[model samples]
Target: MDIELLRDYCLAKPAVEECFPFGPDNLVFKVNGKMFLLASIDQQPLQFNVKCDPEKAIELREQYPSILPGYHMNKKLWNTVIIDGSLSTQQLKEFIDHSYELVIKGKKK
Candidate 1:
């Protein structure tokens, strides 16, 4: 999995939108106007940062070297996943779902 994979996954979701809200090289994926996924096109190893539950983020980091605190996001609430095939596609998809849900849950009320 890489930037293209991330893009495809996000775009496949209903009402999802892709943007460069952070910059040209950085891609942002949103659903219902809320961000759930973000990745840098130029970054090496094709890493992506996703909104995630703080506890889950820590667990993932402990379980896989590919998962770490997001570079530009809240360290306690997000994670950076290296797209190196370390995690199974199913697992990646699940993480994406969790990330999306977490972001949606955090929307202004």
Candidate 2:
């Protein structure tokens, strides 16, 4: 998937907004002012970082080479996913949805 598609998908969620809070190189998507996903705009091969359950994070890293510990993020709770054509679009969207849901769930508590 491309950055536009990824941006659109994230923006489609309720209360979601995009910003460059970490400078122009990083595009961050947030819900209720809390970040759920982040993309490095200046990078190649389209990749993004998303929040994930600690256990599931490890599980995914083991199952998919494109999925790695979040670069420069909390390794236990985040994942850096590469859109290298190794995974389907549906799977990528699922990652975004999971992160979005997790942020919303946290806001409720």
lDDT of candidates 1 onward, in order? 0.85, 0.96
| Candidate 2 wrongly placed segments (more than 4 Å) | none
Instruction: Please give the lDDT score for candidate 1.
Output: 0.85
What candidate 1 gets wrong by more than 4 Å, as runs, is none
Q: Residue 20 of candidate 1: its Cα lDDT?
A: 96
RMSD of 1: 1.5
Pick out the ten consecutive residues of candidate 1 with the lowest summed lDDT: 100-109
Candidate 2 lDDT, 1-109, residue by residue in tens? 9999999999999999999999999999999999999999878899999999999999999999999999999999999999999999999999999999999999999
Give per-candidate clash totals. 0, 0
**What's the TM for model 2?**
0.98
